[model samples]
Target: MNVDGALAPAVESILRTARERTPGEDAERISVDARSFSDALADAEENGRVPLIAEVKPTSPTTNGERTDDPVELAETMVENGATALSVLTEPEHFGGSTENLRRIREAVDVPVLRKDFIVREEQLDAVAADLVLLIVRFVDDLEGLLSAAEERGFQVLVEVHDEEELREALDAGATIIGVNNRDLARLEVDLGTFESVAPVVPEDTTLVAESGITTTADVERMCDAGADALLVGSAIMDGDVGENTRRLVNA
Candidate 1:
């Protein structure tokens, strides 16, 4: 289902909370142990395949129903099924995820965990035991500063982009991991060719992560063939047996 304007209000609320919070008082801070998300992806390659960062989002505006139970169980299953890394949604309102999910998933699995959210404040970054954080290049004003800040706090950055201009901004900000989101925010439609189009301009040394709209082994192979170093898949993997679904992605 299309959710073109659905994301707007949720994002605005989070950004507002980020702006209103005082330093070291975010109340959302959970754990402080750090892991290297970039290194884990580099280690997940097998037969020259792209690594998988299996995500643990309970729900999203694009889909219906909620996954309020067994998030940790699902997370462990993904890790057990050869997940290179883990992505736990920390955005509460729209995604129905909590920092508790991130912290416990980190403790539950040894793999790197990425706090996937629309982060706008340093305090927000301090709220997880996450190895890395998703810094959407579209929402952040100082991409370079946020990149540096996350690195300084022991977390790597996944700079997400939806178009060429945002891709350039991520590159210009010295981002080591760049995520090409296929879902167009304005139209709320996914186009895999988005990654095919934007990936060529990215340098080989950078880890190119493909996000959203992938559902099958064919999609996985297509992304791998298109030069995605890693894939961040959530909804599809959540829709079936976690282990089998993840293995399909890894083998693809």
Candidate 2:
């Protein structure tokens, strides 16, 4: 509940935005006929390929400049190169993201869109047009309630965890899809071992996604060997050739 570390600023900024929203704004929601995000990852695994969830992040707290000016174009290129899903940052200010970009990317691609943001309350889920949403267990008090709320809104929740305790909380909350973030919010440092350490404890039935610190094909191979069903790559793909970099990871 006491937000701190690398996520403190983002969590603070997102809460203000969540508070400003008028409740029930999505009462007459225009539903998106979303593709199943979990199924997409599972299908990739079943077909003997590690799934990829390429991100559409323009900027981040850790980066200095904008990664791309046109998110839709970048998203299309990623999918063309075999990305299974897309994660779009929706938190502005620190992340240089917006809901407009999420909507635009979702329209440009048929793959499922993940609204990657610091979601602390159910109110934030209102008006989210994406097929999936992210919920960090460290920032949430009632993980179960928020998970239920997201599912009720017709969005699959990718419960994020940084370590063992948070992973336990996610499992207790009945999370089916889990993303192990290698970047520690406390120090903004990434250690690939974080996923490797947590992966074995996660139930085989749960879809596990390895996030952060993955850039090269070797890194992708390492994660797959460690039991990652999918990889959520951001800075690595955005900082260079989008299509080429994505292809390298996809073929890895």
Candidate 3:
């Protein structure tokens, strides 16, 4: 079966599983703080280096299997190398990740953690304990309501766009952090030029992040040349020596 085609159902199942795992009282009392993810990135940028958001992803829809199941160790290695933040993939079925992994990774590292998933509903956001939230432009037709609700809940939104129209909608929705994902959601293909197409349209002050298909120091340099303030890398670090590769990417 094509896993990408079943992504929506798989995500729904994961959310239901997360809700089932949480106790009634714990779920009711759980609250995210007022601090946003942007605060962490801003602080890092002020120190004169690009923020590196390293990911602890066990698997992906494209990969179709686990790259690594040890979340805590991976989180530690990322931090030890020079990652400014952590991105924990919480989508269970498609990504081979879970909320338990996210909570464990957060406890394992001190850096801010972003919940990287196809965030489509508010209740889904509450299911995972994340310092930052992601919003995919291709996933939703209405942007205004979603952006407003996310901000109201004290979550920093990383609005992800693959095309110019999506970029425009993200800015209109008041997205402070704009991520240009090179991976096309419709075809599940990656094109590095996607960043080149969208980066210029983003405001100078907005934190620009290049996501997907980045693997080497050369890729990092290319992204930096294209005006990216941060980069989200997963497979390369997960499959290689995490600490060594992370240091090369961050210090590049």
Ranking by lDDT: 2, 1, 3
Candidate 3, residues 104-191, lDDT tens digits: the string is 8887777888888766655566676677878887665466777777777777778888888888878987888899999866566789
TM-score of each: 0.88, 0.90, 0.85
- Residue-level lDDT of model 1, residues 1-252, one tens digit each, is 112244555455665664554425546544445676666766776345459999998898787787766899999988888889989988777788888888788888898888888787666677666788889877777888888888887777889998788888888889988999998776567999999999999999998999999998999989988998889999988876888988888777
User: Which structure among the candidates has the greatest lDDT?
Assistant: 2
RMSD of 2: 2.5
Poorest stretch of ten by lDDT in candidate 2: 22-31
lDDT values of the candidates? 0.81, 0.84, 0.77
Which pairs clash inside model 2?
none
By TM-score, is 1 or 2 better? Answer: 2
